[model samples]
Target chain A: MKKVALLTAAIIICAVPFYGQHFITKNGHISFYSDGPLEKIEAHNKQVNSALNIETGDMVFKVLMKSFVFEKALMQEHFNENYVESDKFPNATFKGKVVNMSDITLTKDGTYEADVEGELTIHGISNKIEDKGTFIVSKEGIHGNSKFNILLADYDISIPGAVTGKIAEEIEITVDVKLKKFSK
Target chain B: MKNWIKVFVLAAVVGIGVLIYVWFFIYNKPHMNIEKATPDYIISASECYDHYANGNNNETLNYTGKVLQIYGSPSSIEKTDSLTVVVFTFSTGMFGDEGIRCTMLPSYSNEVSNSILSKEISIKGYCSGYNETDVILEQCSIIKN
Candidate 1:
């Protein structure tokens, strides 16, 4: 009977960390920049929702298209009304996994390179993407940063002839999020 | 010959004036004035979350891009590196504490700091749609009574 009790206590102790394996942040930051001959465009969306399960290597990100704020009001208006059509497709999401989850240890304080693979959906189009990012594990939380480039044509975001030289065909996106341990 | 020259000069001046107006007013219009604009829907924070939490995507989509005036006690007011965020927590579900997360406008940073917890207050912002777990609002400003 004592042996069984000892085994039960051991299992309970090991299960504690598993319960806190999920990390989430509602205010993740995501920004994109476009460099063209005539102009450079940049926008930032601070209210990004992201979730990561360290144990399972599964991660997800969602951002409202209309949430992206531009430096100029006209650029923002044209982006929503003409380009991405935020009224029709309001949300852009990424459902992916950390391919190299085994290489990183969350309990230890260190920065590890991660290979993330998954599907990114924007403007109602989905594309498989594999990118590299770094995860900094600390006592506070995990800070994840990744920079990648995507072609606007791949996402069906077309530029009008009048502003062909004003917007780039390719845009760079940066993701920065500090995920905290999810607790009930 | 003199009349033709005068007409050409007058046309060129008018064209320049029109170009300037288009550049300043039309092509470079000002952003939406959130402070002066009225809210499209005035509802409680909990009620707003309910529309999304219940998986009513169509109903929830109606609020997107629209300014909302939500009233409730804030769960927490946190200052991030860039801006201040006012959160109205609904529940701690499988993902996390899901609710309405409002990114306050920088101009109202002081007003957000003075916000009392558990005391009913109103906030107005542009509804940016639900991100599965939480309803995101941007350019938020406190609504004075």
Candidate 2:
């Protein structure tokens, strides 16, 4: 009880007051699906950090590259050491804004189609991309989800000839984040 | 006799190659079992948070990508989807927030359920890094009862 109280007090002290305009989630989930000729690979990372500004529709999310847990441990090792190089890059980040911000109504608690555009940095390489998603606001909280595909070659993640058929050229990515209003 | 020997050698070579491939890529390869594995660093959660707050590059270089057994008072215990996350926090920082957050695996759900909240407990997980406020550890498990 005391520790929770103290942590709560600290949160009140240090949190940036975005008020109703800010939403944040520390456990946002991101999963990627790769369909290869030899086999399919899937990995999920739930330790994603995301902050959204409901006022301007600006959003940012980051996931530690090594945080992505794979079903196969060898795949995880290969991913960090060979593909993404998590030791060197550490994280993949997306700093984008909801392009169709004006169309969404946050107070109404309805589904709104949104276009998100910004820089996506993977493996230390940044690329500008635009994608579509949905935003939902309700009395419970705010929810956002987006899906897109990324080519590994675009990020300079090269699959060696030995295992090229075991990996896909374009990996599908899905992002789901639930945010609560930021309070200070 | 020579032809028979050559065929046998080729078969042996192919068998060895397949064995190596299966051993490295397919056999016993999956999510790590952190609960049973030994921790690389045994440090208190508060001390670890202090390093993350004060030490910049050097701190990140040291802790990140390492396995940690962090002990502290549980600030909060919450479940997201099927995963249970035990958070250890300090009331000091720019955000007045710095701590170790451990996400336990599903196999430890029963143990996590029976855990006493607000008590000192130690957990083992991989240190991802300090993300401005909190040091993140994923695929965690209870280490100390």
Candidate 3:
């Protein structure tokens, strides 16, 4: 008990000077499209987890598999149970850096095209990705837009023969991000 | 000697089982409460908006209801040095309207009063009165949503 109290006191003292980095709006939007011979369906979830460090080029993004709601209720369930299995794999994340970190002034308003290189972990698989996007930075906040393609097989996700043609082998993912400055 | 070994092994297994049970179930329960049980003024989202529109200076208001929905994505969830403290943010609003938005901070489970984010969520807490920039929800409860 005495040791625990001492540790607690030490933690409080150490944390006094340190504060939190708040992301005003730390989410984004991602969409999935599966084009079939007869039909093309597109669905999206705007609630995305995203964060950026103004001091460093460090950044991260996440989304809960279960949070992906579709226009059709049955599709959402299939997504969780059959495809995503959200309960087993709760989140997808990406950790990377903005290439030109020093040149960017986030407090000012401007448009920038930069390369973001990171290790993206999805479905318990991690891959190196070098994607580019347009970033808008202003005294107000940060907004980013980008799109890239991902192969289902690259992640070892199988498309059964029954639905093989229904879902595209290569799906284009669009990234729409909006973030706010963390107040000191 | 053989019987003694068997008894020791059984005791070890039972101890491990008890530890696992306590960690996953008993200790994982949420119980953080910010305010004590005292009748306080409770408000609703629409009502809270009305107060802001009316230019009410009262920074505190209580809202009680089940969480109809949780509409934001989280960047990170971390505990602060403070006891049972947390701070995080959701992506700002989408489709044109945007800003700091509303977020759930580190709240005491007891202060929450039976509200779960994934289930029926009712929050009786304080609002810093809506601003064009941010909406703050504090000391809330899950009434039944």
- The candidate that wins on lDDT is 1
* DockQ of candidate model 3: 0.02
- The model with the greater TM-score, 1 or 2, is 1
TM-scores, each model vs. reference: 0.88, 0.83, 0.52
Candidate 3 per-residue C-alpha lDDT over B38-109 given as tens digits, one digit per residue, 9 for 90 to 100: 424544444444443444544322221112122222222222232121122322331123322233334443
DockQ of each: 0.58, 0.31, 0.02
RMSD of 1: 4.5
The deviation in Å at residue A172 for candidate 3 is 1.2
Runs of candidate 3 with Cα error greater than 4 angstroms are A1-24, B1-145
Better of 2 and 3 by lDDT: 2
lDDT digits (tens) for residues B1-145 of candidate 1 = 6999999999999999999999989878788888788999999999999998898778887888899999999988878888898889988765677799888889988777644678899999988788777888888898889
Tens-place lDDT digits, model 1, residues A1-184:
9999999988986765334378888779999998898899999998888888898788989888988999889899989999999878888999999989989999899999999999999999999999999999999899999999999999999999898867789999999999989876
Q: Which 10-residue span in candidate 1 chain A carries the lowest summed lDDT? A: A13-22
Docking class of 1: medium
Write model 2 residue lDDT over B32-109, tens digit each, in one string. Answer: 566677888999988888887775778777888788998887777768776788878775332223577788878876
